[model samples]
Target: MSGTKPMGTDEHDAARTERLRKAMRCLEGGQFAQARVLIEPLCDDRRADVILAHALAGSGRSTRAARMLCRLAHDNPTARHPAQDMMTLLLRHSRLEEIEVTLRATLRQTPDDIRLYDQLGEFLLLHGRTDEAIEVLIEGCRRHPSALRTGNLLAVTQNETGEAQKAQALLRHLLSYHPQSAMTHANLAHILTVDNRMDEALHHHARALELRPDDPHIHLNHAMTLLKAGRHAQGWPEYEWRLRIPGRLKYPAERLLPTLRQDSDLSGQRILILSEAGLGDMLMYLRFVPALVRRGARVTLQVPREILPLAARIYGVERVIDPLRPVPAHDWHCPFGSLPRVLGQTSDIIGAPIPYLHADPHKVLVWEDYMPPRPGLRVGLVWGGASRPGVAQAQAIDRKRSMNLAQLAPLATVPGLYLINLQRGQHARQMIDIPEGMQLYDPMDDVRDMDDTAAIIMNLDLVVSVDTSIVHLAGALGRPVIMMDRYDNCWRWQSGRSDSQWYPGLRIVRQDRPGAWDGVVARVRDMLLPARPDNP
Candidate 1:
């Protein structure tokens, strides 16, 4: 048997290698549990330590993987990449203590390692230890000033800690040193955007795009900047790509309706106005359905059932289909927001007609008596929207978008102005401090649907809001509205236009810079100063 033994005939050795390879394949296929089964026999194998570390990491025992990575890194200093990878994972898990411990140990072994310092500093920032992250990164950057990772984090953390100018300097320095990294350009562009330097931000974003055209995040950021700069010709197309983002709503591939691109006469054509995104988006785009009908096509408005009754009424359509139902036959379908793009709209070519909707006479009569007469100007206000997922994250007024609310305190002080609370929801809790008598009514008790909203708006002299759907509703109903906006405003507002092209009676009050509610409020105040008899 000894003489018959081959050069490498150890059964266990062959089996171990095969099992490890199978575990790797299982991991690659996303079967983590199956991978663990194959990995159990090789726990003590030095050759399989990294694989074991990765498996443990997948199992959520990342601290153990991190320790294994640290030991491996100490023994094999040239293989420090694994250590950096583990640090990144730990940072995501918010395991700050383990990160700090591993980083310190690695730093002791290779004090001059810039990558180690960078990882440590980034983790500190992720954990909200911005001051310490800044200190560590700055020291490392001073030692190895040209290291992009160290310099980038130092700059970002500095900006996070309220030292934007210093952050800008570091980023610009890195850009000057290494102009090829799209990441550096993207970071610099974001900082510039936050600093209210639109021109510089645009330039940096364009540069980043030049380096990496297909990067979706950079594309989204650039599109936002363009929309903010009032350059919508390029923004919407980039914005459309947002559907591809994880957890974002996906319209069917058939929504584009290429098969219906035939030039056959529209005398019998079927058109579908598919709702995709938010209630506001649905309402905003419903204006185009009439145009489709005018082309002799049979048009159907597909939307969430909650808004169907109101949309059908305002849009003047006989058919409003719920999207949750099986789609009926349609020759063509497109997203609600795609109307402008499909129609090839530009600023000068856009047309807006007000009061496109009519409230029921009965509802109007009900509100007419329910609403008290105002002594002077009647200004309707809506401080919140439904707490739908979209509103909570995208449209809801947070501390940043809501500086106008605080500024309205001064508006209340202006005599001959009856401020009515069309506001609703838990967000109304923010208005508890508003002085009494400024409020004319709180119709929220009866305001449940668009009919109620329209009745209340029709009775008011004017509406004032901060980028909520009520602004759109008021504008659609031909009520004069002054829309307050933040620096990073929504795309629908367009950039820099004092008046909305989408709503003829709507005037915009945008921050001269982002987050400057004081200036926006002051502008609105100046426009509505105590009316003289001559002006009135």
Candidate 2:
């Protein structure tokens, strides 16, 4: 009790101040137990109490921390840090309803804070509560009609959620008022590019780049625009700005190659190729490693630990390193994303072999033993992509590209076609709800990573999947793959192309409308009929 209050003396007050500061320092350094011990004594102050709650949460006492946050929020609705902290904690714990209540309560007490509206709307959108997000964002825009950031978010959301006309109208209206806004131009460029309006999209992208020459995000957007339009010669340079964008990749210290040139002779150059982005991108770019090897470069490849066995089998890879460990000694290092820019402008340098990835022959033989005895075309199905809830933009794109297993249940009725499940991650639970009759050959329960997946894929006749890493793996193996694509698909697939430029055996079944997967499913199902073993 005595520790909770300062003695009525200058010496004691000074000691208390020092103690609180030390506790805050501990919290900031993530020493949660130490922070809790120090902050508990000075819990009389609201700021001290907030620190105590943070320490509790950090120490894994999330329920207790959440309760304390609720009380603190109810007592002082205008406290900025605690409310934001509570939102993050609740989101991690999936206590979503409370997040909305706390956000609304904070906004009510401090109605003039425009940031609260933005936070609430973004939270709703991240969780896929589209209607609520739209309402909140609309109200926010109405209240602060001149606010470009919120309006831009609202317009993007509208475009994604089946209201493209409304989104276009909002962006154009915002542009009429704020003609000089770089964000408005960039977002409009995004929507235009998605609709295949190449000329208009490029113009807006140029305008945005002209307005904000140093903005990495705008440059990345413009890069995607050019790449999607198949103008890769011009796009590769713009795409280099992706390295400058925030949260793209993790680099270790200042050890990377200072510069690389396309025409440089690589005779005996020790090159370390680190993964730049997603696993799919790594697969896409590993094709160029053969070229590096042919150039007399000793290529040491670092890939995701799960794919180590598979990556080790690439034709010209001198060494395969695990991604979890620190990068080993090398003369120069290059991330896979930079490979296209370094290798060539539009065309890949020669010697990137087709079917560069191969499964272990023994593993394939073992998996073949577990295959269905019935003589039929073995078709693998991957109905969903990874649900990356932590990254909002990635999650939003996943929602558009992935579909439930139920949407693909109709394929089970196809004669001489047996469906195999090749999906993992949070979405794998959909297998339990497989619509009664769709018997899936789900060897995923025993599969560890891409190595195991590749082994199993070798037993299948075809792989049908949404846009995910599996498609890359299948394509790399030179297997026939039917990719169920979104309307606004990746730049690699390009525009209006059913055949892939990268993989000869891969076929794309694209959605005609945004956020529509039924058409994609139907096309895949219809196309599979000809491939059925009993069709002839």
Candidate 3:
């Protein structure tokens, strides 16, 4: 009986080990559902619980996974797996308070752990708490003077807080000691790029890439630097690495079409163009469809439902379909942003003829009555962009690219300008502060989709907006546009350009410094006052 018991125990142990191995493989392959099914039953096992928490996070149960990870980390502080997993889940959910508490508690238990300080500071910086992050990282560097990563993050936080010189000094100092550190070089390259020191930035960028050839982020940064320098010949190919970046939009590999070599024949080919990224991006990139059709290819565009009506009117488009519907048969597929790379586009060839898009004349006439017959310059105003609440990355961009109606106070003083409230979403409450004498019309209730917005724009004399889809809509319709750009602008705008090469007659009003919307508003006010002299 004892000999039989030993054999039975051996068989049971073998089965458990095999199951664990299979579950681990599933997790590594991103089959989180399969992994969760296998892991949930083994939660009693401590090692399995860590993997289970990860599976829970991957499967969108982030809050539950965070709680489980916190328990595991509290129970076993020596193993970093649980703490690392907890930090990732908490950051993704933007639970900043919980992250601070958990990191502080862990630091108390292991007071000398430099890694905890690095994690705390980096997480704060990611959430845009730059001042607090700098303070923590300074202390971290003081305690562990040899920690390169801590120093690097401190420098980055300093850069974010508008201390570019300090960031450069710290990064250069780090390089003096650890010249082989690819991260320090990359950070320095980024700061240089932001300062518009392209030649020096390219030198450091090349050095960093040389040191870390396998790093996708480094490749992505190099690509942008190349594009900024107008070296599109090399930049386009490097930009393909963006697909490998975490948290960026990922297309199905199987659906990706073969790269169209420069000036390659597309005759008889059926090409599918995906509307990737933001609405503005779709409007900007749709210009290439006609160019593709010129090469004799049948082109189909898949766009969001809201933009379908406008996108259907693009020249040379064989069909416009909803992205939610099953895609039609095609020989090749490409994301909208990838057209420049595939079609050999460059800065010199940009700004393909304007008036590529047209609004329905009937819809345009309908909106004319909506506008008051005021004897003034009609202007459309969009002060805010739609963004998800409580998301760190989205909030950060919104903070830079969006503003409250109150910030446009200078515009209210511009006489002979009839302002129309083109602002979308719940942010219209900001209009409550629109001084008693100033009148900004609100017809947003009737504005249903881009089709309606396009029609409304066609009726307006000019469109004044921050970086939003409205700017793209006006530009595509060949209406005059004034874009209020942030200090660190999008790549499509290119660097140090007051006028966009992609959109003819588009004027940019840029912030001289970050968060300085006052200057931009004042400039727009100054420009408007002279243009409309009939008011005063």
The candidate scoring highest on TM-score is 2
Residues 19-62 of candidate 2 have per-residue lDDT tens digits of: 88898788666676898899888888788888887777667665
Candidate 2: misplaced stretches above 4 Å? 1-99, 109-113, 246-263, 345-351, 531-536
Q: Across residues 1-536, which tens digit of lDDT does each residue of candidate 3 receive?
A: 35544457888778778888887887677676788898787778787887787666666665666567667766765656365665675455555565566566656655566777788787777766778888888888888776788889888777766688898998998998899899999999988887778899888988998899889999888888888777777887798788777755445667676555546677988989987877988888777677777777889999998899888887777989987888788888898877777666533234357887889899999999998686889999998887767676566677778887887877877768899989887677888678656789988888889899888888889999999888988998899999998886776677889998778879999888877889999888887885445534
Best by lDDT: 2
Model 3 vs. true fold: TM = 0.81
17-76 per-residue lDDT for model 1 (tens digits): 899899877756645457766787787865577666655665655556656766666677
Instruction: Candidate 1: list runs displaced more than 4 Å.
Output: 1-66, 72-170, 186-206, 216-222, 225-265, 314-318, 345-352, 383-399, 404-407, 432-440, 533-536
Ranked by lDDT from best down, the candidates are 2, 3, 1
| C-alpha lDDT of candidate 2 relative to the true structure | 0.81
**TM per prediction:** 0.71, 0.83, 0.81
Evaluate candidate 2 by giving its C-alpha RMSD to the native, one decimal. 5.7
